[model samples]
Target: GAGVSQTPSNKVTEKGKYVELRCDPISGHTALYWYRQSLGQGPEFLIYFQGTGAADDSGLPNDRFFAVRPEGSVSTLKIQRTERGDSAVYLCASSPGTGVRSGANVLTFGAGSRLTVL
Candidate 1:
């Protein structure tokens, strides 16, 4: 894909159900990120994958949230026991990468998956 692509542009699920959001990053991008944005606030980082491994997952809220990037390109974010408080727009982004000391990072974001837990 020319840009980051996310599935289920809008998802409405009941509380306690499960949800999976998928993201297909741009070809050749080594860095992929997941973020969640609440009303009137900026996106909050959920996880960051560098290649096939998760370089950082400290932003994941709890055990109910997890993400995987098995092929280093496409990724999935799984949410279990969804709660009404979890309703938000899940954003996915991909970047060329930041080398050893490169302080610049330009990310291309997808039209986020809007999850509405009712």
Candidate 2:
């Protein structure tokens, strides 16, 4: 019954460095999603995985952003060449199934991984 969790609630790095943010979804969840939120804006979808496969990754901003869920459980978001524009809260959520309307869309978000590129 563990909820989703992210490491290093806050991260600070140079503009060209790389960072890896981790997420641990709840037990028994079959769907996991990643989202990024800027100040005063809603969380934007990044990617989603269903049973170890990326169900949707269209929201990934660019080549600098990537994610993986190899075992349908834990996931990680990797950022390359970090930029100031990349500073934001990275959130992770998970649900019981893959259907958007099958109660899987009601995401229970982690506190978030706040990244700061200086």
lDDT of each: 0.95, 0.91
Q: Cα deviation of 74 in candidate 2 (Å)?
A: 0.6
Per-candidate total of colliding backbone pairs:
0, 0
Q: What TM-score does each of the candidates earn? A: 0.97, 0.94
Model 1 scores worst on lDDT over the 10 consecutive residues at 97-106
Q: lDDT per residue, candidate 2, 1-118, as tens digits? A: 5788888799999999999999999898888999999999999999988889998999999999999988878899999999999999999998887654686357778999999999
Instruction: Record all residue pairs in model 2 with backbone atoms less than 3 Å apart, i.e. clashing.
Output: none
- The list of candidate 2 runs beyond 4 A from truth reads 100-105
In model 1, which runs have C-alpha deviations exceeding 4 angstroms?
none
Worst 10 residues of 2 by lDDT: 98-107
**TM-score of candidate 1 on Cα atoms, chains taken together:** 0.97
